[model samples]
Target: MNVEFINPFLVSLVNVISTMATMDLKPGKPQLKNHDIAKGDVSGLIGMVGPKTKGSLSITFEAPLILEIMHKMLGEKPSSINEEITDLVGEITNMVTGGAKNLLSDKGYDFDMATPVVVSGKNHTISHKSKGKKILMPFSHEHGMAFIEICFEDI
Candidate 1:
């Protein structure tokens, strides 16, 4: 896979998360996870398909991070992960993926992206069909941790 193809995804992650959560993020070296990634506390999934291959983009975080993010996004403290909070999570991923898509298109790479699907609770995995690469970027806020992972199959 081309390194150029990967950079925009990372850039979009940093930009969206930072803008929405008011936290700074950096492009750390992409690393692979050991086994299948179960949904931690919150997860946002968006599918992408192009001529060469098809895959999905997901961002996952634990409860602390999700709570803080929900608070920041809504400008108030959320008592729990209810429907309102769930809506916010899906919207956040939608914004992040949209940002990435725009950036990627600017660089002449275009594809169709599905609407974000948000899943909560636990014990679920973002299953991939092919042997894929996992790129993890960790972000921190005063309250908690939020990370972005780009998992995609190579064409």
Candidate 2:
């Protein structure tokens, strides 16, 4: 994957979390992921297909971070990962994907996005649409850590 493709998602993640959750995020170095196991407790995955590219984007959040997000966004401190938390993850994924899609579209990379899917478990697995290597971008906030993974290829 071209490194250029990663920027929009990065920007979007920061933007969405900052604007919606009112959280300050510092992104860590991105790395190539070699496995399907998720790095966090819950994840939101979505697929995109375009004329020039096709791939998937996922956002995974640790329990502490997500609970903090829930408190900030909904004014409720959830003790664990529940349906509401999962739904929030899905919505965050959707917002981030939408933001990135707009940025990429401005660069002439228009695509259709699938509905986001939320998965939660101790060590859940993510199946990206593309077979390419996943790029894992980790972010840190005052509460905890989160991750964003992007896997795509020019089709």
Predicted model with the maximum lDDT: 2
Total backbone collisions for each predicted model = 0, 0
Over the stretch 35-148, how does candidate 1's per-residue lDDT look in tens digits?
564456778888887766567777776777678766767788777677877787788788878877787788776678888888887545555455677665565556655556
Tens digits of per-residue lDDT for model 2, 1-155: 55677888999899988888799889988888877645678999898888877888889888899999889988889899999999999999999999988988887778999999898996566666576778988899878888899987877
Off by over 4 Å in 1: 37-39, 123-125
Against the reference, the lDDT scores of all candidates come to 0.70, 0.86
On TM-score, the leading prediction is 2
**TM-score for each predicted model, relative to the true structure:** 0.80, 0.91
Q: Worst lDDT window (10 residues) for model 1?
A: 122-131
What is the Å distance of residue 77 in model 1 from its true position? Answer: 1.1
